[model samples]
Target: MQVLTITTPWFSRAQEICAKKKFDQVWIEIVHNDLEETFLEWVASLSPIRIGMITESLTYSSDVHEKEPTLEERKHKVERRLKYMTHALVCDEKDVGYLKTSSRVLAMWWTPAVPKRFIKRQRKLASLPYGIFIGSVYGERSKIIQNPELKELMIHQQSPEHGTPYPFFFDKMHGALYHFLKSRLPGTKLLFLFYLHFLRAIRQRCFSLWLEALQNGCAVICLPHYVKTYTGRVVEGMAAHMPVITPDIPDRPRNRALFEDGVEILLYPENDPIYLANHIRRILSDPGFSQRIVEKACRKINNFHTCEKRVQQILNWVETGEEPVYA
Candidate 1:
C-alpha cells in the first residue's frame, strides 16, 4: 500500500515514519506556502487509499485579523478535509468529532524518539542540585517569571524560537527581565539561552540541550497554557526520567488516562507557582519518591509513547479499519 502524508511544519515523527520502506511507496508533501491550494492539489494527486496527516488547522485564513481561528472553524476545516482522503490522522482528539460520519479519523499522539542511553544520562545528570524550565515567555508562560515563588529557584530557562512560521509576534519584555536579573544578582544561579531560528535547527540542538538541562536539574517544570494538548516537553521529560510538573487539563482524556498524579506524572493547578515550587522541592528532597516516579514514567513511555509504537498503531488502523487499542 502507498501512504502520502500532507503535513505542515514537517515534524520529525512524520518524517521518520515516511522514510520506512515497508510501505509500497511513501511520500511527504509539506505545506510551506499557499497552504490551502497545496493541500487540495496533493489530495487530488494521491490515491484514495492514501493516509493524510493534518498537523494544524486547515481553515486558518492568512487574512484573519491577526487572531487565531475559533474552535468551530478549526473543526469545520478538519471535517472538510476528511472528505478528500480515505483516512485522516490528527494530532488532537478534540478535533476528531469534526470528521464526516463515514470518515476514518485516527487521533495520533505526538511521540518522542529519545534513545535509552540519553535517558539514562539525563537521570544521572538530574542528580545535580537544580531545576530547568523549557519554554517561551509568550502567552501563559509569562506567569513563570511573574511568580514570586520562582524568583529564588536555581532554574535554567531555555527559550527557543517557536517552530511555526507565522506573522504573529509578541514582545520580548521577559528577555529584558532575564538579562536584568542576571546583572542585578551576580551570585544568582539562573541561566538563560535563546535561539533565533525556527524548528529546522531544533532536531539538531533540542536533544543535547534537553539532556543537558535534565542532567543538571532535579525536575522539569512546564508552565500553564490554554491549549491542553500533550506537548513535546512533557514526553521528553518522561523519556529523560525527570519528574515533570505542569497544569492539569481535565478535558484532555488521553493525558488523564496515560498519566497518574503523584505516580507516573505530576499535575499542578493552573497559575500556581508556589505549588510548582513545592513539587520541585519535594522531588529534590526525596530521592526514593523521585526515583519511583521516574521509573514509572519511563516504563509508560517505553510501552506506549515511542515513535516505533505510534507507527505500528497507524499501520494497524490503516490495515484493519479499526481504532488503535492502547494498553
Candidate 2:
C-alpha cells in the first residue's frame, strides 16, 4: 500500500524507519506552487516513493492576507485532501480533529533516542546535586531571574558554588529553530512565519541572559535533546532525579500531570509569572521539598523513559499501523 506523508522525510529518523520498512509510496508534500519544477526535480532524484504536494496556500501574493482561507475554509481543504490519501498520519492530538472521517488518522510520536548508557548512568547518578531546566530558556527563565519578589524569598536564589552550563539551553533553541525554519517558510502564513522568526530572535538574545544566570550559580543544565524535537530533557531530568520546572498547558493531560503540586511534579502557569517565580523560589529555598519531588518523580516514571522502550513503542506502532496503546 502507498504511504503519503504531508511532511518531508529528509533528516527524519522516523522517516528512515518508515522507509526501511518499505512503504510503496512516500510523498514529501512541499507545498510550493511557484517552485513546482524545482520540487519535482528534487523528488525525482530521491527514492521513487517520494512525491511533492502543493496548495494555493504556498503561493505569495500581495492580496494573500485577503485570500487567506479562514479556519473553516482550511478545514474544508484538508477534508478535500483526505479524499485522495489511503491513511493519514498526524503527529499529535492537535491535528487528529482535522482529519476526514474516512481517513485512518494515526497520532505518531517521534521516537526518542535514549542512550542505553544513560539509563545505566541514571541508576548511579540518582541524586540531583542541582535543579535542571532541559528545554528552552525563553521568558520561562525570567520567572526566576527577573522577579525581584522571588529573589527576596531566597527560595529561588542559588548559591555561587552551583554553576551549571548554558550550552544545553543554547543548543536546544538552536535545534528547535533549525527544525522550525525547515518545516515552515515565508509564504506558508505571513503572520505565523513572522511571529516564529520574532520568537527565534528573542530566544537568540535570551541566550546571554541564560549564561549570566548560570554564571551566578543557577543549578539548571540546559542540554540538547536526544531526538531534536522529542522531550529528551524531561526523561533525562527525571532519570537524574532532578527537580524539573517546565511551563504547563492546561489542556494537555501529560503536561497537567507535571504540575501535580507537592507530588512527583510541580506545575507553573506562565500567565502568572509571579506565581511561577514563587514556585521556583519555594523549591530552591526548601531543600526537603525539592528533594521530595525529585525522589518521587524518579520512582514514579524512570522505566517509562527508557530508549529501548521508546524504540520498541515506535517499532510496534509501525508494525501494527496504530497509535500507541498506553495503559
Candidate 3:
C-alpha cells in the first residue's frame, strides 16, 4: 500500500514508478551522510511492505587491496533488512541469485522515460564525426579507447562527477571539434552550433548526455561491463531511435529475451575492440541496416519497456502475489 525508498540518483527510477502508482504513502529518506544508519532507522519506523531500492555493496571475485565488505556481510545486511519487509527489489538481476534469502526477490530494471522533445529534436542537426561515451571510463571502455584501430574514431567522453580518471590518450585528444577534425569541411561553421546544442543539453537538464549523443551522433556506442546487468542507457538509445553497439550479455534471461543480435541491437563478444570498431564502421557505412535496427528497437521499447508498463507489472505482482509474465 505504501512505499519507502532511499534518496539516491540511481533510485530516481523507482521513485518515479511510486509516483505513477499513487501509493498510499511514499516516504523518501534523504541520504546525506551515514546512509546505513539513516536507511535502517527509516525502514524500522515505516515497516513498509515492499522496500524498492538500496545500494549494492561493491565486491570483486578476485583479491583487491581495498577493505571491501565480504559477501557474507552483505548477505547478512540483506537478511537483517528483509525481516521487516515482505519483498526486496534489486535493480540488477545478478543479485537475485546472490542474495539467496527467504523473502520474495523482485528483480526490477531501471526504465527511464525518454522525453518527447528529445525524440523530436533527434537527427535534426548534421551528424557529427565522433560518437559519444557518457559513463565512467573503466573495464572494457578503457580498453576500447586504447585500441589502435579506433584511433581516428572521435569519442566525446562525458565523465560523471564520480568517475575514474580519464586515460592519458583521451585527455590529450579531447578538445574543440576543429582540433580533432582531420580535414575542414564547407560546413565548418556549423561545428560551433552543434557544440552549443551539446552544452545546452547539459545546462538545461532536458535529457541525459547519452540521449543527446543518440540525437546528434551517427550511432550510439555502449561498452557495458562484463557483468550481466542491463544498462538503462541501452533502452534510452533505442527510444531515441539510435542503433546501439555493445557487448553480448547472455547470462541473464530477461536481457537475452529483450535483445536479439542484429535485430534489436548489435552484440559483440567481450574484450574484442577490433570487432567493436568494425561494427561501428558497418553501421555508419550502411544507412539501410542502421535504420532497420533502430526501428525494431524503438517498437520493442514502446510496447514492453515503458515506465507505465513496468509500474503496472510491479503493482500486479504486489496485489496478486504472482509474478507477471513478460513476453
lDDT of 3 by residue, 272-295 (tens): 878877887887788799889888
TM-scores of the models, in the order given: 0.67, 0.47, 0.67
In Å, residue 248's CA in model 3 sits off its true spot by: 1.1
How does each model score on lDDT?
0.58, 0.43, 0.56
Clashing pairs in 2: 155-281, 156-281, 168-222, 168-223, 169-222, 259-267
Q: In candidate 1, what are the lDDT values of residues 201-301, reduced to their tens digit? A: 44445565565555557887777654445566777888777887778865668656767899988888776777888888888789899889988888877
- lDDT of candidate 1 at residue 57, scale 0 to 100: 36
Regions of model 2 farther than 4 Å from truth: 1-92, 100-105, 109-113, 120-145, 150-232, 257-261, 325-327
- Encode model 2's per-residue lDDT on 20-82: one tens digit a residue: 354444444332222234444433444433322322221122333354435345445554443
TM-score result, candidate 3? 0.67
Model 2 TM-score is 0.47
- Ranking of models by lDDT: 1, 3, 2
Q: In model 1, what lDDT does residue 291 have?
A: 83
